[model samples]
Target chain A: MRLLIEIEVRFGEFVLSVNESLTLDGVTALFGPSGSGKTTLLRCIAGLEPRAEGRIEADDQAWLDSKAGVSLPAHHRMAGMVFQQALLFPHLSVRKNLLYGWRRRGQRPGPDFSEVLDALRLAPLLEQRENELSGGEMQRVALGRVLLSAPRMLLLDEPLAAQDERRKAEILPYLKRTIREFQLPVVYVSHAVDEVMPMASRVLHMDSGRLQSSAAARVSGGTAFGAILLGATLQRQLDSRLAVFCVGNAEVIAFLDSDTPNAREVLLAVEPRDLVIATGKTDAPLNAGAMDCTVRSIGEDETSGNLVLELAAGSSSFRLEHSFARHSDTVLRVGQKIRVLLTQPARVASPIVQSGTGRDSA
Target chain B: MIRAVEVIELDSLWLTLRLASLSTAILMVLATPLAYWLATTKAGIKPIVEAVTALPLILPPTVLGFYLLILFSPSSAFGSLWVQVTGQTLSFSFTGILLASVVHSFPFAVQPMQTAFENNGRRPAEVAQSLGASPFDAFITVTVPMARRGFLTAAVLGFAHSVGEFGVILLVGGNIPGRTRVISIDIYTHVETLDYASAHFLSMLTLCFAMLVLSLVFIVNRRYPIRT
Candidate 1:
């Protein structure tokens, strides 16, 4: 689905203005911090924001055109949105809630009712009430309910943010599998880096109610400056607390403070501040191994006054921060070769990307 | 002779039940949309509308009856329209008392429903709409089902309040046996005639009935409390 949006919404003192054209196929992450207007943008696309005034077109359908006074109500639009909270109808049984949308899906052709039930593993909980289900189960049912709505596209507002790591881990696989099965374009909104890296094919950053940049240009995960390593597969657990992953051709070993996830494939995120770049080619003594990298670009961070160096290793690109006052001896240039020591572990997440797409690391 | 007295009592009791039932039904139908609007609207006139709806709660039933009596009089446009259509006055008639009862019980019917709609909030309805249900469809399928307890309470309270109405009925619907003479009017007649026996019997019945209605409300609330 191709979405063209140019909208402005004012909520008291906060103004959310967005103008972007996004072609969503798989999962496209709207990554930002809290109160950064990511959810507002999703609401605009869903036709839920009444104060939004501008043009929004999805797949050649004008969902909203303020100039022409053509604004479709939320129900008329084919975009299904899952709120941050799992807003399953409390009075409805699990089966009824799942079928609530399906019965009203109009003539849209999409997945079968039972197919969604089986995919989201909601068959056993059909007769159960909403209060009886766990948080993760509620979220899954919520997603399945929207899926049955036969929407042209899906808009998820941090669907997994309410759950803990363990529940998130348990539900991530089901979410990815179901999305892949349906092949519907999704605009997933989230603030967590690990959550976005695994699921998002492309990331759009937002801060202070404005779009910062595209993910290819720069990916700042909320408050942390980091780079997402997509399609990274977990090799194995070296021990209970340490695990290894393969990103492109490089092996990334991560320190697991929590229990290791059951999924074999995982994505890795590296914080630039956590990396230690050295001019020498010798293997530095660190718990995790280091790899050879060539500096792709060098820039200075305006606020923090730290030298931000962009490096490329194998087919993957990484950003590492080097303080000029601390590392004055090592002069860095755009084409200079360097070895980045992994003093800190790369953040690992369960993979949402399919196996074939993992090798397109660059 | 005893049969005649029993026949009169039964007619009054039956008339009271019919009046209460009709008033409660009409009130539900009329007040639901009003209450929903009061609960959801952000317009500047919301406060004014709310105050008008709640007037029946604070003002004495005599005051409202006086205004309604004038409104239903032949001198007024609505009253004349009713006369031209039905060829009968709205005073001292069952239909007149029914309309008066509905007006008196408006707050009893609308307050609970408005509170229910407020507690239910807009999220569920929004979710239903996002899933392709129209606004009205969402309200019926989602909002109404979730707030069923409030509707139950409102219905019971409205019915009980209408049944116990004496001041409004006496003002607008004068003593006319087998027509405007409800149970409350019957009890009032017995007292005025110094017939304590009939008055005590009918009064006790209404007391028991009122208690039953209130108990039903409390039980429903306890059984399935409204979700925050």
Candidate 2:
């Protein structure tokens, strides 16, 4: 499914103007800091903000077109939205709340109630009142309620922001299951980068109500270490022959691999200091994974007395920063070709396309 | 001491209950929409409309009584208009007394209902709208149910206020026996004829009835405190 939105909205002191189109076969993360217009854009897509200008079309259907003077209301748009708060009705039982939207629509074919209940794990809480449930249980029920509406698109606005770590860990797997099992396209809004990393296939970055950049990043599990580069395919199992991955354009082979079935796209952790740069291909005997790379850009790391180099290989790019040394080997400039070597290799499981969609096996 | 004179005062006591009950019922039906509009409308002239509704609260009873007396009299414009429309004068009639009571106690009925609607925050209504409910449907399903306590308060206050009215009733419907001789007027006639025992008996009954209605107001309001 394709979702297109080009809308400009002005509220008192804040002005938001966004024009972009996103393909939705997988989860797309609207990633940004607070007050970055992520929620506004989501609302506009749902037809909640009628005052916004511009057109929005999803799956080739015209949902909102300002020039044409056509705007569908929120309910008619049929996009299920879950807010930060669970917003369960206090007076209604879990079952009644789940069926609220279904009963209201009169007669429309939608997701089966039992299926949604089973997916969200809400069957046990069906008879309980909203106030009686814990935070995680309430959110699970809220998800069930939205799913029962059987919306064409799902909008989740910081669904995990209110939860504690324990609650988040408990709900994360269930959410992953929903995305994989249902195959529903989702526009997930979040301020936390870590929260979106594992769930999002594509990340749309925003700053001050403008699109800064959009990139297709390989999804990785929660880790404190910097970014990892995964290979396209896992070739073969080597006893000490670690899987190698290219950073930017410079390729490095690592001697680490696990026998896990899903490990195809392996990850290599590179500390900036471990990389050695030369003016030309090195004559010295090198480690298993090392390659000739060209310096594309250079910048200083103020915290650590090191110079960061952006190296290029064909169209790909990666970074290598080295600390100050008494004997500086070479002064690197943009567009300068250089060779780099890795002294030690840390191997990881190769990433595999576990499900129908591509998921990092790391 | 309980006396035969007190036993004879039951008729006026019964008449006061009937008048208060009827007037409260009429006001409830009429004031609900008016109160809802007052609570929700953002029109520029809303304050002006509110002031008009509150006229009876500030206006002296004697002043209101005089104006109502003139309007219902046969010689006035309204009296002539009523005669033309219904072929009867309005003065000293049962319907005329009811009209005077409704006007005098309108603000009491409207204030509680208006306050109730204002406290129900706009979020619930917005949620309802998002869920496919039309404006009318939202008001009926969400707004009305949420403000149930307010309606009860308005009804009880309106009934109590109507029963306590003296001057407007006296001027609009004079003390004609078996026709306009309500409880307050009965007490006045008994005193004028030097029948202190009968007057005292009716006075005590009116006081007790008023206290009872007031307690009912407190009880209902306490049980169902309006949810914000």
Candidate 3:
């Protein structure tokens, strides 16, 4: 589904203006610091913030169009939102809370309540009062409650922020399972980069209520290199050397010190600073591999005048950072003539091997 | 002599209970929204409305009663308007006494409810709305249940205060035995007639009832403490 959002809202002294479009077939994280309007943007998408002005369309359906005066109320939107606090009804039992939305919409049962109960490990707390449950348990129940609503899209605003590490770890697997099984588009708002990096397939970074350039990238795995390695075929040789036997249309060479007889696939990481950019052919005795690459874009880091070069090897693109003085010697611009020389082998590390597949990967 | 005095006291007790119960019921239904509005509204006129609701608390009972009497009299504009609508004069009637009791005891009903709503906070409602509940649904399902203690406090206070209302009832409805005269007015009449025995008995009953209501408020509030 295509999710397009261009909205501006004012809250007291803060004004939030966002213009973004993302495909919602997978999880997208709205990542930002606290009070950076991550939650406000999510609320706008969910139709909870009425003051927002602009157009929002999900799956080509116009959910909000300020000029056309077409704005759906929160209830009418086909989205489920989970808050930081569970905010479960004190008088209602866990079962009732989970079934609240089901009963409200009178929709046919989509996900089995019993299955969800087992997934969230809430079977033991079905009859428990809201106040009696622990914070982690409350969040689990809250997630179940929203899922039972059978929404087309899910909006979560820091669901795990209030929990401890143990609780977060406990519920993350179940959350992953739900996302995989449902395959619904999800917009997760969070300030924790670790959480977003793990769960989001697309990360949209926000700062001071504005979308930052280069903050939107498809996050497939822990590192950009790991994502490339997932689909690449590799050959490991002696002398702690590894070769990317095949990477789509390009080949890469790296060094691996580990010897595992059954190791067919391996993970790799490369620091941009470790890479050297060259405009001419150089034969050096350094223990590094060279690959032919073209410069895609060149930009400078705001804090440090270090040049960040976007380079493409075949269809795969990666980044390399060079110092300001080095970059100044070369005339670098978008579509500039350049070659990236890896002075050292890209460090190869064992794949962390996530428990599940890409389902949980936002 | 004691048996006859007990019977008369019971009659006044019954009148007091009837008036308090009816007035409390009316106030509860009416004040719930008022309290909710006071707790949540950002309307420019909220302060004015709140002040009007709390006016009886600061006004002397006699002064309040005098104004109510004038407001409910047959010759007054308000009274004539009520008569035209209901085909009956408001003053010196059971309905008039009920109106007077509600006005006098409004703050008792509203204050506790307002505090309860305010203490419960707006987070739950916002969360509920995000979870697909409409505003009214959220209020009834999430807010009302959470603020249960406040409702109880308001109900008890409104009932007890209405039972003790004297000046307003006296001025508006007068001592019309079994019709408009409540326990407080009954005690006044008994004392005015030099029946010290009857007056003393009725006053003690009123005191016990008030204490019971007050203790209930304390116990309920303590047991279900609000955590905002």
Considering every candidate listed, which one attains the maximal lDDT?
A: 1
* Residue A174 CA displacement from its true place in model 2, Å: 4.7
Q: Of the candidates numbered 2 and 3, which has the greater lDDT value?
A: 3
TM-score (2 decimals) of chain A in model 3: 0.62
lDDT string, candidate 3, A210-324, tens digits: 8632222222121211122222346545364555433334444566545422344443444444456665557533566555666776666565666656666654455555674
Off by over 4 Å in 1: A215-221, A224-268, A271-362, B214-228
Error of 2 at A44 (Å): 3.8
Per-residue CA lDDT of model 2 for B98-181, tens digit only, reads 888988989998998999788775545544545555557767876776777788878888987887778888888888765667
Model 2 reaches an interface RMSD of: 3.1
Sorted on TM-score, best first, the list reads: 1, 3, 2
lDDT of 1: 0.80
Judged by DockQ, which candidate is best? 1
Clashes by residue pair, model 1: none
TM-score of chain A of each: 0.68, 0.64, 0.62
Summing lDDT over every window of 10 consecutive residues in candidate 3 chain A, give the lowest-scoring window.
Answer: A218-227
Q: What would the TM-scores of all predictions be?
A: 0.79, 0.64, 0.74
**lDDT to native, each model:** 0.80, 0.69, 0.72
RMSD after CA superposition, every candidate: 8.6, 10.0, 9.1
Model 3 over residues B1-228: C-alpha lDDT tens digits? 878767767776888898899999999999999999999898899999999999999999889989989999878999999999999888999899889899899999999899989988887776676567888998898899888888998888898788878888888898887788788888888888999877887788778878887887788678765543
How accurately is candidate 1 docked according to DockQ?
0.49
